[model samples]
Target: MQTESNGKRKRPKKKGSRFMRNAKGFAKQGIFGRGTHIDDDQFSYFINILDAMKAGFEDVEDRVNMANNVFEQTVDKEIHLSSNQIVSKAIESLIGFVDDAQLERFFGKFGDNLRPMCSDRFASHVLQKMLEIAFLRGLGQAAAQEQSEADAPGPAKRAKPDAAQVEEQYNLETDFSDKHREQCRNFVLRISKFMLNNLEDFVWDSCATHIMRSAILCLVGIHVPKIAFEKGGAELAKHRKLYTVPEEWHEVMKEFPQRLELWPQFVDFPYQEHSSALLGVICLSLSVVDKSMLKHFGKKILTQSLLKPNEDNGDDDDEKKESKIEIDDDNDDQGNNEKQDDNEKTEKPNSEPAVLLPKVFHYQCAVILLETLLSVAGAKLLTQLYAMLFSGRVAHLSQQQQTNFAVQRLLQHIKEVSDFESVFTELQPQTEQLLKMGYTGVVSALSGACLRLGAKQAQMIAALQSALHVTGDKEKSKLFFNCLVKLKPHELLAGDQSGFVHLHGSLIAQHILQFNKPIFLVNCILELPAEQLSQIFNTPNGSHIVDAFLQSKYIGEKSRERLIRQLDGFYVDLAITRHGSRVLDQCFKAAQEAQKLHIAKELSNKANMLKGSPFGRLIYTKYRLDTYKLSASQWQASLGQQQQKEESVGQTNKRPAKTATELFKDILTQ
Candidate 1:
């Protein structure tokens, strides 16, 4: 009877049985359920909640909090699932529902709650989702508005959009409405402020510091989208809408300069730890700020302040004294076994010394900021930076290494943006001064810039002539050599100019050959007129260049033929000289089969004259060995045939065939 009653009764349904069942299923599979099949009803329910959230339904906050709790539980139960998976799905569902009004209201009430979540890895994702949703909604509204305006009427019926209107529309389409823009700006600013306000709490915490840095970078990319514009210009504009700075964004731009002013305070921090993050923010800021503002604020505050020598050397001295006291305390511990009374031994304080900005740190930051300014602000800031570099003000700084590095970086930036000829003209008078100061990098960079700019042959030749005067130092000469090699100044060197008259073409050619082996250099050497080639081939140092040319694998077939022709009458003369004989040997080795045979025949004619000289004797012996080796092989083949004939006749072959040694002696005697 009990079994029959149990069978008759139906099981009672649990509270939210359907939701629980679906949630369990979703936890097992993905958001769309198993495979490609989607549970539309369940998806619609999820989207409905997003709609409610966007509409600010009376119980929306409570519902969202409850949903979040359920999501966390599901994630906990299903160890395979990630928090990001749930957050991504939630964000996707809310994308269509989220609008500017919703974001403003959400932030207004919950902004304070958002700051603490930035430090939480999972919670930061949700905050980022909120920002992304707000950005997408703003974009949708802008695109819709643009389409409406575009479809409005013809120019006859309505005035076409002016440049200002077009620019404004572009800003809206790209960045969003001014109100939404402000909210996004404030969102990032608030996070930055939170980190700054709670500096001690976040400074040593890696996670918090990373969040802060990421937030800053995000703000930089968003607020300074125009930075890309400065680089790509109209070429970038053709494919996508360009960003224009709006009047409303002026408030956002103001935050950067204020932050830049705080740079000095951070100088005492571990530069290796914080410099990249700080420089990234500053560079991005410089790229977006107005040129006038950049010139005024960046030049006056950042550059000028950094360029000046540190006035607080006295503070560094005090810190050294404090360090000495700490060392003495450490020594006291090792010297005595008995513990001293606190009164007897003065206890030094354990506090860190106050960090004054180092001169090197300021110089590094100044150089980086100046480079950023030059890239974005164009010629105006470039002129200012150049003036500052040459003004001798930096010489007064404590560290020359920092100043030199700054100059090198500045010159590199200038090379990229300005005409090299103009830069050279401006810097030419100071070239000697720069060299005297041991700034060879500047000279090298300047030479490269000039060459890249396609500076005229005469001018480059003159520069090379002037630069060669500082050949006393091996390192300086190497720097000049590298510059000349990269410049491929062979064309200028080949030309008949008075400037190169003072310069030894062969010496320069030898230097170029040693450091660079480009095909063009080989071609240049081969293409030299007979007079010049002969001149270079005659000199002891110059013959090495000829040897380099012959030995290079890049020497073309036609160039080889031309080179062989040039050596037509000079082989005997070259074979007698100490350096020239090496070149003659290389010529024989590198020449094609036909050229090699011709050269061997020509040298064999002068074997007597060549054999008299020490270097030439080696060439003479090589020639004789090569010619006789094939003959000796043929003689052995013939001698074996004769011996076979004798064996067939059943007779012992008593006549011995000539050995290779005997054959070589016979050829030499003949």
Candidate 2:
């Protein structure tokens, strides 16, 4: 489902700029924006911005001079430079990537330049980028670096600096801190004034609306990474840069001039009917990802890695590279052909016919933007989002091109039974159709949401079973499990045919295993012959299914023991590999006393192989195979105390906290 698509699925294409004939226009050429009497200095800023984004301040001086000089030639006296050209140039260069020196200059010029650009269609984008870059650079210059420096220990004061004495020390302070920071603050204040000054112009004017949203991001220091919508789903969605700014920046926005505050503008935006799409995306982004997590993880990782750019379920390989988007038209056409061929071969005669999705111009930006929002959304914020978006439209949205992605992401965040049912009710009937129609990502995300919320496990399985054409218990064959595991269909079971770990399908398997009543799936999985299981045990993600089984509270201890018993003969083989060794280690930890002995005895005989592997040696030492070799009885006895301690610790964690009154009464009695 994630790796292949069968439906006539439509993906948003990058809208190319209007191409001009080479011989027709007798003028110097540039990327994106073009105009009469072009100002080389202004346009070169974009070239500089592009360099900053790609290479990050490398050869800054050379870029600055070269960029400043690019459009320097004098133009016709009567003609004026088009501001739209400026926007075309600016939008191509992401605002988040600009250098600080360039930022200081932009902030200084923004207020004077913003007025003309704010209302113009192409120019508004430039306005938004300037606001983002100025605040981003400003926050880094002041809040992140300066604050760290302020409290940092001096050479002499490192040993001692009492609070009272340090406060008493002479300190003369100029308002704010550095010139760069002042420019940032002024830029924010001026923008605030501009917005407050032109309330109706901003509210009614379509182009100016997003600038308000950008300012809100600046005020809050929330950067939703630029949403690049292309071909493919989460499997191909690689690590995208996540939004980050200093925590101290929030305080700075708070102290802005009261008359120029953005609150009124924010409050007024939602009343406009059209604001729903834009406002919904931005608001959810802020609400879903908590302020605290952004502060903690935001600094350490890129937003995509932080929010997780892939699927919402946090598949094992969350840190992997960009999803391979089918960019070339010919290559994309070829890929579609292959997927269709695969789908046709796999389609079951009894399987419900999938509804064909109409190919349409995808609202690619909106989809990407919403997906980005869902990525950052925190667990605590799920309740709010569930109430806001999921209201009897889950299926309707899933059927459409743009909203399907939003639904896919939203489903991943579902936490309550009510929320799941609300979504499941609308989506249940079409679940099979959606799966057949190449929307397996939607199904995979739904499974993940089910597992996360602990809702509708039986119903979810039923929907999938029917979809997989294994509605009857007897019909559930290795092929059914295989189809579900690969998220692709097969006319017959062929060993090792499933390629590159069908990511979405594997996610479905992992999610199903974690469910409270995952016996059916577990049984189906256990049937995957030892050879197949061996392959699964060693895979980067497939092994996660094993982890899900071992780690799930719902899966019975007996089922876990059965798994260990099943792996009995292969214990040594498993212990000598990376992922397999981890699985073995987990199995031993979760294993019953006898099961542990079984694993240890097997590993004890293969000491040479175990010691040879880096992972294997750790397993050998951790399991105390040498002690087992000395005496099985002694090894078994040595583990008794450890097992007892582990059980006690587990019980302690599971135990409820004492009430204050009860604790007080117990203390008095003692």
Candidate 3:
């Protein structure tokens, strides 16, 4: 030192250092260094410090190799462990890391120091694993901590809390069990969080049975408190899973009425407001599924909870009341005087349990649950539930809303899911239930749904044909016919020519004629009267009701004879329009012309007798004798004068001559 250190200071390479000059040489030679260090302390110190600092260096060849190895391993493991079993195992291990206190500490403490002690690449791989373990453990710890804090006693708290505090406590215990239960007492909020934070990863990630059960338990556990199980029920449920039906479910299965009574207090717990409310509806709907589930308690509980008085700030009771009133008032006054109006309006009693739900959402949920019950539940139960739901007797929603909802649901089921095909079948439970609902425009709903779902023309026509054959209700049949008229080749009926509506209309028109329902037939004529029918015929390949009738296999000889007899009543109205007038004139002229031709020869013998009756008889005898001698020009002139006289009288009477062929057609239709 005193001689000014003439030689340069040689920096020693750090142990496990990748930046050492020999590192490139070692890597190039494929020589692995395990727990080895260069003899140069200064160089080793610099490399170790760089690694510890987590800073990248361009000149560090060993560090680069380490990074490359880490990237490769991550890609490889990710591909290799992609199965559900692997994901499940990994999730279990991750959960174990969080749940185990000792492992958490071990990973936390050793994670930093171990990094620089090994090769940079190997160190990084270990570090990533350690971090995942830490995070998993931390999440469990946080959940546990929150649970404990919730159970903790307050300092010098009042012996009896205020109503607000009491309510809060009840809410905390029952509904607010989600991770953020304290922050927001909303089930949707919690579900949204869970879905956003966990669902996507868990969907694809490997998870163990316990881990998956734990996740599902977390969701189910949120509902148990409101369900009024033991104090530790949520915790117990966390361990328990829905691998099979609960023993309690079976025990209370026979005592559904009793369960129904207590179920409400638990149903709308503060934590699971909307979902529990939905589940409660589903629970009540079980009665619809299995009538045996309809315990007195269950019915009472449903009545109480669903019909509860709303005192909350955001309650929609008043608006619903107003809307109901408005609908009722409108219904009472309309001139249409629909069949539905005569039904009694059933009001939910004020003593009934508070619905605590938003009405629109409630309506939507009720509709869905009702439809589901119809599909899966027993007939007796369906009858009861349908009676109960519609018993409120207030069809509070607008006609358009109801129709739109039905069509939308039907379309969604048909077009979006294959499982929903059951609804379209006659054998399906929903088909019978749909008939029982007795919706005024139910046929319209079906037709609209079929149109939107892209149902084939033949299939749709067959469905209608079947419905018509089995149906006993005339109004329903009429509604079906009317719907066909409204939507033909518009809104839903697409294609250049081949659609169900075209065929359906023809079939229905033929049915009306065959059935001899003159009013309906007349109504059809009036709506798309004879004039319109002819116009339709004029369109290329557009066969009117007449053509359909002529071609119909359904109409028998007897029915056709009856229809032809009835045509006389329609002739007067038909004559007003151009097509009707033309058809009538042609028919009359043809009949008269044939009659005149047949009778012309017979009239000569009768005319010869007219001259012999009196003194003129002798002169007539001469005229009759002279007629054979009369000139061709004179006979022709006499015939022309007689025809002119007959034509003028026919015009004065405003009647057209009838044709024999036209008369025959009329007879055939009758």
Candidate 4:
């Protein structure tokens, strides 16, 4: 009974001691309790301390709240914020990169944090909110800045929001707003890259993987907003609010040229359903963003991301290390060796991880930047800027490939824009440069457009000629030729007479001479009226021209029969005469020499067919010949002579006999 000092207890000493220890333990548990009750005194003390702490926390929260508000407001006011600022803010906030414990309290468990929340239902809601807020905020801020800029004077004079201040203010605002969209993009990419690079324990179901994929899909929808402007009303408004090409943003755009490479790292993987969706988003973003920016970065990002690994290092160790792949072997000996190696490697950490991008990002960024210069300002300006940037570093790419890509991208833009026609008209010089790009598709599309626009025949011809010179593809050449043929007779035949005649004359002759494969022009020529044919085939040097045709590989066995048919068709239409006789004389010699009896027979049959017809009368009257010198006997004798001459040549040279077509090719080239 020794515990009666405070008149609280008169119990036994052992009982009191045991109870006190229990009480002490219970009090400690209250400090670290799992939802258990505390005694009255403990409760009172806790309430007092909690009140004081809450007051202090409230003051800090109030100040932080004020700072956050001011930062957001100032960032909204600063119209001159760089694209990095805008993008960084949008991405950082979208992923909730900058939020305080408040956001964490609500979403930390469920958000794309290191470990997601315990409850799935809560996570989905939190993620959805983060995406919505980020998207809305990014769009809103962009719109608000544009509106403010419209109301204000020049940016420099508008406000003194330096880079740091702009970054600090908008960084958190957009970060909070976007909820860490960029981080999502980055994380998904990082996870995918890592998983692909390191297979073991790198499960596909990583949370970072899902977040990145979702974020990428969100990006894919980025361009959908721009589609509203495709048809005029609120067109500029849409572009203005959502996708702008502010001169000040040039530097910001520079950073993103290689952004596409990040996409390809995951895009090419075997089971990259998630990664592919993300890549699609990236492509959509590239398509929707400022055209100039797209032009600048599209290729750079595309190339860097798509480039394969090269192995030319002199070090065998590096080469051997690079050669390593996912181990599939099960042999005991190999497994032992592999495990040992792995353990050793684990013991000795790699000095550095392989860089996925290296110069790829820089290249893509440069290209996209160059593309932007070409898009907004026009080719002249872009070319000038291109010249400036392309001096030293661009030596990696071939000139031809670069030009091809540039023209291709330009055409893509032309296809993309609804008002491309109007824009093209306003920028003729630029169009001309695009044509000068010498890409087959680019030139062809432009030429077709010109034809559709009712551009002058001279222009069309010039454009086609330009296309033909640059391209080596036979299909494209044929297309250009056919297009010219279609346009010439209708649009060009009777033009300002000199230009028309000279143009067609030069082009037709060039085609006849240039294409030794087969003279499609001859078929076209035969289709012309007799008068036109006469004008073309009955020139001062008609005989010489005939000799040229005979020497051509194009007029060999296959084409010769066709030409004979064409000639027959032409003769049937014509009232044959002395001039026709002269032409026939030239063709007769080649047929006789080649021993083309079929062609000879056809010629004679045609002659006989015309013997009593209108052509017969014209022929007889014009020739005034008493008799026909070509006879069956003479034709047979000429054939014999050609056979003898061929035998003699074979005996003298011991050369292999050739087909009629082969002989024609030999003679024409010789």
Q: Which candidate's lDDT is highest? A: 2
- Residues 547-580, candidate 2: write the lDDT tens digits: 7888888888788888888888787888888778
* Distance from true location, Cα of 399 in model 3, Å: 2.8
lDDT score for residue 397 of model 2: 66
Tens digit of lDDT per residue, candidate 4, span 182-263? Answer: 4433333333243234322222444334344333333322212211002211332232222222232233322322443444
Give model 1's TM-score versus the native structure.
0.35
lDDT of 2 at 130: 62
**Every candidate's lDDT:** 0.46, 0.55, 0.33, 0.36
Predictions ranked by lDDT, top down? 2, 1, 4, 3
> Any residue pairs clashing in model 2, and if so which?
40-71, 236-323, 238-322, 238-323, 242-303, 242-304, 288-377, 288-378, 289-377, 289-378
Q: In model 1, which runs have C-alpha deviations exceeding 4 angstroms?
A: 1-113, 120-250, 259-276, 279-283, 308-358, 361-370, 377-405, 413-444, 448-670
Candidate 1 per-residue lDDT, tens place, 1-670, comes to 0011211113333333354356457756656433223355545554454345445434334544544443443322221221233333443233223345544554553365644555554344445444433333333333321222333345543456532233234334453467776676566556555655665566545446555444443443332121100222233232222122234434444454555456654443323344434444444444443445555654554454444545556666767644544453576663252234322433644543222333434545455444444444445555665565443333222124444445444445553344444556655655544434444455555544443343532454445645545245543433343233322222233343321211223433443333323443455556556555555465565566666565545555677678877777678777877767767767766666566656666676777888789878877775563443456455335545655775777545232565433332222111
Task: Estimate TM-scores for all models.
Answer: 0.35, 0.54, 0.26, 0.23
lDDT of 3: 0.33
Query: RMSD of model 2, in Å?
Result: 15.7
Which of candidates 1 and 3 reaches a greater TM-score?
1
Model 1 worst lDDT run, 10 consecutive residues: 1-10
Tell me the tens digit of each residue's lDDT in model 3 across 12-48: 3333233344543554454323322323442333334
Lowest lDDT 10-residue stretch of candidate 3: 221-230
Worst 10 residues of 4 by lDDT: 223-232
Pairs that collide, model 1: none
